[model samples]
Target: MHKHSYIFITFLSIIGLLVSSCQQQTAQSDEPQQTATPKDSTEQLVLLLSPDQMKTIDLDTTSLKQTTIRKNMLLMGKVSVSPTHLTSLSSVVGGHIKTLHIIPGQRFSKGQVLATIADMQVIQLQQDYLTAKADWTSVKENFERQQTLNAQQATSDKNLQLARAEFQKLNATVHALEQKLRLLHIDPTTLQADNIRQTIQIYAPFSGTVNKVFVNTGQYVTPTDIICELIDPRGFILQLNTFEKNLPGLQNGQKIAAYTNDNPKAKSTATIINRVSSLDDDGAGIIYATLDQPNPTWVTGTYVNADVAVNNYIVNSLPQRSVVSFENKQYVFVKTGESSFQLHAVDIGESSDGRVEIRNPAQLADMPIVQKGAYDLLMAMKNKPEE
Candidate 1:
């Protein structure tokens, strides 16, 4: 009986030790859980501040100053042939192209021969013209003699009148022959029976580079056929298309800067020489803006960008972050005084870079606008009531 009692006591002592260890572990777990509750509560109670409340917290202000403002509008444009420099060459007579005196890209002066055309019809016309000139000369001599004889009564009045009429008719025939020869590309002074030519020489009407040559040696050509195209490099214009909404600010003589994609660093100032009133079929519009100077780097058909200056308006300007939008309305926090802020409505205008035009009379010129810590102040103002 004594041995069994001793064994029972040993078992009870072991159970008591295990229970104490379990209680110590439970207390340790509860202590950390209790500390975490306060931390979670503090995290949930976040504060949000309005613009006015933000301005009340140690805000800064500055005096406003008047400054010149300029408005700039950017537009895309392209290089095009100036209307003044574009010319088309057409053949005056139908014939086989005998020879091309000038190739494409060759420069020629006014009245210079560019090509020659050989036509059977031109040969016949030249022959007729030569014969008419000879006949007209003979008739003129006879008429002069008849006039002298009529004054002396050496010849009958009827005979004198007949000679005079014949002379006038021959003169008209000579004029017609000259015109026909000219149309056939024959110089009147170079016309003679032995020197008569069938090939008509086409002359350059203007001094410019030949941009296009449509005919080769031995090619057949007609009077209506386009022979060549002349382009004067000296005459160049920048053609730019702009939006219709920007039309009101655009006018002839307005200054603009043009730059090309290839040479962006090189800029040229041009004037608005023309504006088209029509809009394109698409909702997108177009306006013609011409440049003042001819830039050699500006190639025809190359695209460019243009910046045009428009009218300037006065407004209170501030950093872009100073004003924030909420619920479709714009608001700015104005510093009423030290440790005070008031919400003010403002009309905004043109914005560029980091600055925005603020149209408000609340004297924002010298006031310190919340630039860096606006969002933080906003949160503070929202939680001020709860605090």
Candidate 2:
């Protein structure tokens, strides 16, 4: 009986010890661990700020609200001159450039002399014209005399016929030479041996700024060579490349807002003049638009951003300053709790009147956003915690 009681007492003691050990472990597990593991980088970004810091930054919150906004297709393009407004200048006849009055960026009007070319061919052409005129006059006089003789029966029929043929031949030569002289801008009626010129002037066919000069003074150029390039700034148009799928949304006479990448505040309005139906190798289509009011300051080849209206509807939006851009992704802060904000990635659209349109409105509906101090929250969440 004594052995039995001893064994039973020992078993009871062991059970009490086991229960005590388990209770100790339960207490330890219930307490917070000293070392906390950091979350994965792709997980939700969070920021914890002190009350004083939040007050100092004057953190403000705004809720999502519905407002009328236009759906716009953001397009990237460049300024281009119309084909008809641009031209390449060249001489009709080959010659040595005697003088050049055109310099890069110089503006010239139609019929203005751009340069002068000198060659012996021009003088020779004038001389031939004078000689032909003299010969024609002599032959014509002889033909008249023969006609009178034929009527009087004083000359043989063969002689009269020969004189007539010779006169006709000389007349044709005179007419051909006269036209040649006119082509060189020489008036055949006023041209004489002493007054013939060895140079021909090149005139501007239209008014525009000289963009480039190929030939310098005293250089020989052929008719096919390009003398210079000219462009009219007034004919500047905006050219944009869009996908072939967007063709149905584009049309003639549609309004477009254009601005350069360097200066977004300096915006200009334009109207769609054309939309090419053909698709390029990449399935891209070209859009051409004319400036509503042309400006001389708009230079050709300048990169521009255009907002083409696609549709209009009510959207939730926020102030431009409420959003932050980091790592090429746009973000905004949502006030999850007092002194705590959650960073959320958002897809944004066109901005106007200091407000930006949010593409995903339902995600942020009825939620308070960090409007005033969003950047401060972004820095706190993005930066690593201090040691």
Candidate 3:
């Protein structure tokens, strides 16, 4: 009986051990399981300064503004004269140049005598005209006499016909000579035996500055030979080589300002007259602009710089000093508290006319931005001790 009591006690001890084990398991489950505690990511860079510190830093802040910025498209080009403005004069007849009253770079008036050519052919033409005119009178008198004789039945019809033929032939010869003399710039009615001239004076067709001289005194020339070239400066233009991307912002009649490297302040005004797509290479085209009131000092092939206003837009912006650079990024200080600011990163667009475009303005949340002395805040943030 004592041995049986010992076995029952042992079973009771084992049962008590199982109950404690179950209770411990239940307590372990009931207690909160250990999990990774989430790291704090709510903190940001903030600068806190006293009122005197702000004043000492020369810090200024203002609200974002809608600014109208005028952008310009720059072009490199050269000044040149239009093709229509250049004129070339040639000789009418082949002859030796007698005298040249003009030289290259000299200005001349209209109807001015440019040169004279002495030609034997012109003299022979005049002599033939006088001879034909003199023979015409005798032929006419003989024809009249033959007509009177034919009426009196003293001359045959054949004789009268022969006389009439001679008269018509002589008349035709005289008329032909008159026309030939006129083509030589000689007046037919004004020409007489005593007033015949062997030289023809070439007159200026238009007034302009001589650009090139091809012939000198006593040099023989042909009708196809060019005597000299003239240019009218009033038809000057600016030509630019522009890429295809620039076409969208350009059009005819747009005004542009042009200047040279020698003098930038002396700007020349011009208006776009045409755009040519021919001979386009590498997606480039030619743009032509008429220069307004071109300076007398400027000549063709002058290197010019042109500025065309384009892509005007009204965008949210701030002063250039308002934005600061940090870690190869752009930042602006946003006022979050009376004396505290948060460094806010922003996307920027074009910068011009002392203003910079705020591309991601929505991120600002209508916060006031630190202007004028934002760099000071950057310095302060850099020097601040870690929390």
Error of 3 at 97 (Å): 1.6
Q: How accurate is candidate 3 locally (lDDT)?
A: 0.85
* Candidate 3 worst ten-residue window by lDDT: 38-47
lDDT of 1 by residue, 251-359 (tens): 8788989897778888888887777667787645555555666675555777898878776534457766766664466656655554545555568766765667766
RMSD of each: 9.8, 10.9, 12.9
Give TM-scores for every candidate, taking all chains together and pairing residue i with residue i: 0.62, 0.58, 0.56
Worst 10 residues of 1 by lDDT: 39-48
What digit string (tens of lDDT, one per residue) describes model 2 on residues 107-189? 78888999999988888888888988988888999999999999999999999999999999889999988887776678899
lDDT of each: 0.72, 0.85, 0.85
Candidate 2, RMSD to the unseen true structure: 10.9
* Residue-level lDDT for 84 in candidate 3: 93
Of 1 and 3, the candidate ranking higher by lDDT: 3
